[model samples]
Target chain A: MDFNPIWLTLKLACITTLLLLVIGLPVAWWLSKGRSFFKIIIEAIVTMPLVLPPSVLGFYLLLAFSPQHGAGKWLQQTFNIQFVFSFQGLVLASVIYSMPFMLGPIKSALQQLPVSLSQASYSLGKSRWQTFIRVLLPNIKPSLLTAAVLTFAHTLGEFGVVLMIGGNIPNVTRVASIAVYDAVEQMDYHAANVYSFILFAITFVLVTGVFIFNKYQLKSPLE
Target chain B: MISINIEKKIKTYQGQRILKVSGEFKSESITKIHGPSGAGKSTFLKVIAGFIQPEQGNITVNNNAWLDTVSKISLSPQKRMAGFVFQDYALFPNMTVKEHLEYATADNEWIKHLLEIGKLETLTTHKPQYLSGGQQQRLAILRALATKPQVLLMDEPFSALDPENKLALITELKLIFQELKTTVFIVSHNPQELDGIAADGAILSELYINN
Candidate 1:
């Protein structure tokens, strides 16, 4: 009946969604431009998370962030940050795991917009940055909302990556998904059911909201 | 004078075709460009507006180099300061009629004058989606003029207007172009669309590009 795991899961999802949104906007915009070999490679890397199993990503992240050697060692010594088996580690893993959910919708929406929109803005003496913020981003509101909600829901339901890199450790790293597995393993059916229902209900509401909002915005120009 | 000697390679459905245009346009005059379909008419306008970069070319506006590939000096679209009215109207769906003009210039009086010229004073609150085709087209033209640009590029500007509205709008635009001394480039399939406006001696020049 401990609610710490639920709170921690919500916090992680919120933080991951925010971080990805800030990072994804520029990356998605760059990718949405006409294709090049370099861009194609970067896009493939970004999209890999969607198709690749979460466990594979988790395994690599664990190795790369382990404090014993490599990047993990440098980060731990220089920044005094330990990514493996820590709450911060869970946040990093969730951001990577939920990246495609955040990027896919925004990228496609940007690509779908008519090129003339930017051209018109530019011809009016608007700079590229000004055009992106004032014109391009405003036209894709529905897609932005969809991306944010999907990233949040996807992060909330994370299991494999969190379990691998952020092993169940009370409030620090024990999110709802990990808590459910721990409860079931301990034969605590009631606790497991509570955590499962909460996670399921939250994700269902988020996804349903996205669908309804998108349907309402079906008449949008970008759609 | 605005002088241009530009050559660009454009990909057409048939194959790769080159668009080569060489012309000298007098400042503050209007030029009507007529060409058949797939003749890269719109592409030519875009190149002058700095939307498309020509492979090798030089564009000098009033003796100031806007683009020179040899020296690698190409001004960005912002620096070029050309106003464009797209064939599709290209109005911002999120912005209202007034916001569009306000986005371009801070002069309230100019915006008010533009609204009256387009006969869109009452529809200032409406978004492009709410406006009819003709209304949207007028808004696009009005928005372009909002910047008070020295150079204006329009592609099929009056395609959606009725004959009555088209003539009226053209009459109003003639006075405004002269008053502002704006250099204008208009592309149209219809040869007679701007007969009187471009037929004025020394004020009009005609150019034709064939695929």
Candidate 2:
């Protein structure tokens, strides 16, 4: 009956989802606008987490952030932050884990915009950044919503990355997925069911909302 | 005063070539760049607007380097003040007409005057996606005109309208420019050529666009 792990998972999912949105939007915007070579490379990198088994990405992240790497030593020295098996480590894992979920919709929405819209803004003497903020961002409202929600739900379902990075230390690192595995290992079906049901509900609602929105709300402004 | 000089511009896409115009466009006149489909008409416009770079050439507007292959002086569209009206009426779908008009700081006493001139006083809040072809055409014209650019560029602006509406839009555009005295550049394939021929107030800068 370790409820701490379940609570920790929810907290991690929310925080990781927020960070992913912040990080993913810029990546998506760059990918959407840049030349094919850069766009292709970044897009490939973002989907790498989804392509490989989660355990692979998790193991790689652990190596990247371990004391053996200069980055790991610098982080520790500068901020006293250790990410080998911490909540921050889980967030890093989740950002890679759910990048595609956030980036795909944003890229699609950006592509749907008319080239003239940006041209019109620019021709009126607005900078590229200003045009992006005032003209481009407002037009892709549906994509932004889609990216945020999908990333949130996708991070909730993350297991292998958290398992590798978080190390299942209850209240500190252990999360719902890890808790469910623990319950199953202990033959405690009831505890596992609680975490599993909530996870399922969250994903179901998130995806269903996307379908409804796409069906009724996204009648593309560029006709 | 606006002036554009282009030298030996060439562009090729997937082994297909279009647009080979070598001439100068002066200000205070509506120079219609006429040509058939795949004529590189739009491509030429884009090259001057800073959206596309010519394979080998230099373009200067008012002695300012808009594009130069020699010293590589290429300016962005925002810096050029070359207004464009897209063929498909490229309006911002997210914004209402009022927002679009206000966004560009094109709001002035002159706009109220052009509103009367262009006859666009009523459709102030509508978006292009919601408007009909003719309505969108009119809106595109107004949007470009709103900026009061030294050189206003249009790609097949009146293609979407019937004869009467096209004539009406063209006549109104001529009258407005007669008052404003701004330079204009337009592209027309055929059928649309008839309207360009009728802009009597605008001095012709360069000739030979296809029908």
Candidate 3:
């Protein structure tokens, strides 16, 4: 019933989705268009979280975020930044955990598009950036919508990584999923039911919306 | 004049074959590249357009070196500004007929003129899906011409047109080419398809590639 966790979770999801889009768009574009052995390696790394256990990813992130270690120590010494048990830590972890959800659909959509579309744009005197924005982006709306929704929902439901990297801190690290877990741990069946129902309903709606959109895309002659 | 001397190795199902070509196309003339399937006609066009990199090549358009392997100077496609009508039409599915032209240039008068020439005035608001194959082909041609490019590359441009439409469109295209002084290179499997246009002030240059 606490509102702080809900607001924090929403904030985290929003930030994570935005960051993933900024980071994932180029990655997806490369994965779709590039032809190199390194391309396969990069793709494998991106998709690792999808198959690897969430706890394993969380444990690694937790170690990397610790101030005594490589990346964390460098970040702290250079920029006075702290990751473990912080809002930034949760965002970083969520972005990594939800990357495949954001990238997979987008890459598949771009791959499905005929390479001629981009070639046409280029021959029409548009730069690669211009073509990507004005032409390629508009044609893949359904996939982009699916990516955004899935990323947002996945970040919202993230538990293992969030718990490992960001130990529960009121109004900071605590999110809706963590709140539900805490409610059950305290034997508060009523609170757990309330949080669980809310999460379940929201996720169901988002996933259903994506499926309906995917169907519409299939029926679309333009695709 | 566009002078091209390029060598590219192509990997086919059978084996690797080198695509070696060297030619000079005059300004404001139409050059037809006739070849069998898998002759790398499309790949040749792409190399000129800066899409595909040839292992060893140099393409000089209007005295500007678009691609020079020795100096490692390869201008990107946007800088080349070569209008291309792909074999598959390559029309943007999301863009309407009018939007396609609008995306290329901001000149309303030019677009109006192009719409009239392509006979797509009524279908300006229609997307590629709503149009027939011939209409789509015409749209692709119009979209390519929208840029008023100095060099135009077309790959099997008239494949979908009916005989009557083909003749009429070819006549109109000849006048446009003459007026604009545009250099054109068209690839075709059927050599006689562009005869009408060639006879009408389109100086014919042939480059044959055997599969």
Query: Which of the numbered candidates is closest to the native, going by highest lDDT?
Result: 1
lDDT of 3 by residue, B1-211 (tens): 9899999999877799999999888999899999888989999989988889999989998899999999999999888988999988888988999999999999999999999989999999999999999999999999999999999999999999999999989998998888888999999989899889777556888999776
> Per-residue lDDT of A98-177 in model 3, one digit per residue for the tens?
99999999999999988899999988888889999999989999999999999999999999989998999999999999
For residues B1-211, write the lDDT of model 2, one tens digit per residue: 4444454344444454434456666556777776556557787788778887776667766677777777888888888867788887778877776666677765677667655655667877776566787777777787777777766778888788888777777777776666666677788776445555455645765556432
Model 1 residue runs over 4 Å out of place are: A220-223, B199-202
Q: Model 3: what is its DockQ?
A: 0.67
Q: Judged by DockQ, which candidate is best? A: 3
DockQ of each: 0.66, 0.58, 0.67
Q: Which stretches in model 2 have alpha-carbon errors above 4 Å?
A: A1-3, A34-39, A68-70, A219-223, B1-18, B106-108, B191-201, B209-211
Docking class for candidate 3: medium
Q: Rank the candidates by lDDT, best first.
A: 1, 3, 2
Model 3 stretches with alpha carbons more than 4 Å out: A68-70, A73-80, A221-223
On a 0 to 100 scale, what is the lDDT of residue A168 in model 2? 80
Q: Is candidate 2 or candidate 3 better by TM-score?
A: 3
Give the 10-residue window scoring lowest on summed lDDT in candidate 3 chain A.
A214-223
Q: Give the worst 10-residue stretch by lDDT in candidate 1 chain A.
A: A214-223
Against the true structure, candidate 1 reaches a TM-score of 0.97
